[model samples]
Target chain A: MHTLDVALGERSYPIHIGRGLLDDPAPILARLKTPRVALVTNDRVGPLYLERVQHGLERAGVRCTAVVLPDGEAHKDWPTLNLVFDALLGARCERSTTLIALGGGVVGDMAGFAAATYQRGMPFMQMPTTLLSQVDSSVGGKTAINHPLGKNMIGAFYQPRLVIADTATLDTLPDRELKAGVAEVIKYGLIRDAAFFAWLEDNLERILARDPDVLAQAIERSCRNKAEVVAADETERGERALLNLGHTFGHAIETGLGYGEWLHGEAVAAGTVMAARLSRDLGWLGEGDLDRLVALFERAGLPVQGPKLGAERYLELMAHDKKVEDGRLRLVLLDGIGASRVSDAAAPERIAAAIEACCA
Target chain B: MHTLDVALGERSYPIHIGRGLLDDPAPILARLKTPRVALVTNDRVGPLYLERVQHGLERAGVRCTAVVLPDGEAHKDWPTLNLVFDALLGARCERSTTLIALGGGVVGDMAGFAAATYQRGMPFMQMPTTLLSQVDSSVGGKTAINHPLGKNMIGAFYQPRLVIADTATLDTLPDRELKAGVAEVIKYGLIRDAAFFAWLEDNLERILARDPDVLAQAIERSCRNKAEVVAADETERGERALLNLGHTFGHAIETGLGYGEWLHGEAVAAGTVMAARLSRDLGWLGEGDLDRLVALFERAGLPVQGPKLGAERYLELMAHDKKVEDGRLRLVLLDGIGASRVSDAAAPERIAAAIEACCA
Candidate 1:
């Protein structure tokens, strides 16, 4: 077992990573402020892990109720998010009731948000069951439900009491989701962890093969990087904006294609390639470096090419992203393999060129 | 103008109170982050003051787009909140765009919640047009929408950049609404300031008559007390809970009678009487103190009697309140005429007695 702390002053919390950590569950159980807890999961992941988690909590003398939402990115909307609220309120769950998010990103985001807003707020913990969530979304306090017009357009930065990334849960995860998780894992390295980037390059094969130690290390390092960034800037005020490296482009793709049409990590994977390509166009990144970055995403089974959305359409959609400031779209682009920073160009032509060049 | 600050460390902001405070618009405009602004108001308050606020922002170089919602507590829900999001997103307002909440409590709560969630959040200013909002809800950062099961069941603890409490706007406020605002003003005194409570007693006629100087002093003092408590406990972790002296009983009345049936301040007025009665029953408050509190509500033309929702029903409803810690109903009972504290009684019998006694 490995533990990392996101040092956010009084808001600091621990992220636990290990295989079969759900079996004992002492740490997670001990964190609950209430004897009764609501476990929010989804149909896809619930069947595989719900009973185990319930038994684990029950073993520790805590009462557990489960709310199983339908699985998919599309479910990250208001109506669906309300199911968790209805289940909790219908049960007459008091403010002290702890919400345990027990699925992937969609469930985590919705449950975290439900915990944030339910009765002004309630205590919650994250038990991420997927690679993508374990390494990125689950570690951060950013929680939201998608708006009809945009992805994750409405949400809050409400932190959880604890985050449990039981890597064994990923044993049941699909290959596509596994690869998508690697996209964010690569992101942490690209943003600020050059050593971890080289480590990922060397251990990509073992990671794909599901070597437990290698995967555990991968999760820990990614979380460490993310935790540090979040701790420094809990609300994405300044340095934290660097974490949205490809999200500006990625959100545009997601919103333009309709939320669930493409997986989030898939869009981000493609988006990162575009950011790298843009960096090259601006002469900040060498052609060889851009090629290597695209090759890395391709090797991870991610899409190197973005969908053929027109540059104007992409630009229009990107403007609605949370990153847009003062009418200019600020994007986190790579200056090199392991360096990223936020930049806004006055010239639109270059952005159009990058969008044109990176698409299928 | 009377400007007081809510000293919440870095999150601190100023509350400006007086006649024609909205007309000048310099301080308010300087607080906005972008040239564009989205003004969220309601039908009732919109036709009365929207044009003035829009003109104010425009005069200061802001492009204001208005999204007027239906008025009243009933509209403080998700669908109404979405209207604000739709207006901003449809217009493609960037993240830096500021949301100006230009109405009473309902508008301020929903608009503040909108600002907290829109694009993760945007800068927002509060221009509370109603006395209830100006004295209480707008001064603090507690923004929320109602759920069918409870009042303020869904919301966030998000603060505004600046609060413009234009006492002059109250000139157009309905008599009932103006009296409702006094309930919260009275709350400030009941919880912390005996001097303010005595001042309210001495100047009830002047306040009811809408004497600008007296009302401004009341608003400033009320805001100062609220700002101090909020600064000490921004998230209602400790001392802040004392501010909700009558809120538990008050929210029960509001939720029990249906959201819009009784004005929030009216319910709070009756609730405060109930709290005083409970304090007397508990031997913490003298009979004279209770009489003084009830008489103050009477002079303000606020309801001193709660609707007969039944004791058991009130208990059941309050159990779902944000204050319920591990199933114990925490009530803020008055220690005397000007002192209050949070206490979780083991028995609900006294609360039941108070509810039964205070009801019409």
Candidate 2:
């Protein structure tokens, strides 16, 4: 098992990524404050790994209260989140009773948010079972639920006590979902690590083939990159905005098309291309460099073109981005390969051109 | 005007307490990040103060999108909180658009919570009109709404950009509501300031009579005490818990009796008496001191005895307190008159007995 720690001082937590970490109780038992635990998962993963986790906890003398929510991005909303609250309050889970999120991104996001606000706050751990969560959502502490008007419009930046990413769980993941997860993995490379991008260019087939060693390296490297960035700016005061390379455009796509119409990473995949095109229009990237980036996403079987939403609608939706400051949209854009920065200088017409061109 | 700065590092904000703050645009204008503001108030406080605040901001060239929610604690729930979010998204409010809460504690809390989570987070300021808010809620960053299961069971520790406390608005406050606000004013004195408690004893009539200068002094003193405690312990780790002198019991009372049935400060007033009795039962406080405490609440027109909600129900509700650790309830009992500390050692029978005795 490879462990990477996200150094956020008192809010710091370790992310353990490896195959078969789920079958062990030692790490899970170590971080808990009490013997009682509230395990939050979704139907998809609960049916798959719930018994094993429960058995592991129970074997270590921990009591478990399982709350299984409906699975899918569509269910990531306030009403579904209330289900977690209802179960917790119904079971009389105390503030000290650690919440264990044992599923993919949606479950992890919802559970982390629940822990953040339940009785003001509570301790929580993450056990992400999907590649999307394992590599991105589970490590960042950016827990959120979608609002009717925007994706992840409501949430908190509450960190977990521990994160266990069992790559073994990915063995059961659908190919399409695994491809979508690769989108965010590629994001780490696009934003900061050109070597990793070049590395991805060579190893995309092996990574997608679920080569355990290759996948492990990708996850470890991705988390290491994430940990460093998060350590520098835990609250997105400045540098953290660079990590959201495609999210502004991605969020617009997700919100415009209705949440869950496209998996988050798929929207991000297309959005990254839009950002690349905008960067080119801003004279920041070459056409060849942009093609290389799009080629990588295409090779991973991810979308390179966003949905045909009008430029006006894309701008309208993107304007609602949380990163927008003083009525001007702040978007993360590439300066050169492996270098990115947040800028509000892109002209609306140029951004419109990029969106219209990328959609076609 | 008296200003008390809540020194929470970067999240620090100043609480401006005086008459007619709502009519002056300087304080509000100086703190704004953008020209656009989303002003949130309730039906009750809106007609009385919203126009002046809007006019003040508009005169300073700030655009206003007013969202008026239903009045009272019954409205401090998710449905009403969502109305703030809806108005924000409807107005196309950006992350930099400041949310100005223009009412009492409920408005401040809902708006603050909405600002904390809306678009992930946004800038917000507090315009606290009620005495309860000016003296307590507006100074600290504890923002939340009621859950069916608990009061303040869901919230975030999000600080505001500025706080405008208009003592002039108190002229229109109902006598019962003013008395309820006095309960919290008295709480600060009971927890950490014997001199303030003594002063309250000497000046209760003047305060109840709505003397602006005297009320301003009371508000400033209470905010100074709160600002110190919050600055020392931002997340209720230790020193901050002392500030919750009667809040756990108070929350239980509010939740048990149904929210809005008893105003928060009324519940807190009775809960303070119960904590004093518990302190006496635990041999930590003198019976004479407990009597003096109960007498003070009586003199302030607040409840001295808790309602007979049944001892078991109190225990059950208090068990859900955010302070509970390891399934054991951590309660803030008086260390002596003018001092408090959190302890988990109170025997269940003794706590039940305190509840039983205080109810009668």
Interface RMSD of every predicted model, in angstroms: 1.4, 1.6
Which residue pairs does candidate 1 place in steric collision? Answer: none
- Looking at candidate 2 chain A, the ten consecutive residues that score lowest on lDDT are A319-328
Per lDDT, the best of the predicted structures is 2
Per-residue CA lDDT of model 2 for B246-323, tens digit only, reads 888889899998889999899999888888888998899988888888888898889887888999999999987888
Candidate 2 residues lying further than 4 Å off, grouped into runs, are: none
- Chain B in candidate 1 has what TM-score? 0.98
Judge candidate 2 at residue B82 and give its lDDT.
91
lDDT of 1 at B221: 90
Model 1 Cα lDDT, one tens digit per residue, A1-360:
899999988888999899888777788767777788999999888888899989988977888889999999977999998888789888878778899999999899999999988977889899999899999999879999988788888998889999988888888889999998999999998889888888988999889889999999999999999998998888887999998888888888998998888888999988998888888888888888788778788889999888999999999888788887777788888888789888886257888899899899
Going through the candidates in order, their DockQ values are 0.77, 0.73
Q: How close to the true structure is residue B79 of candidate 1, measured as C-alpha lDDT?
A: 90
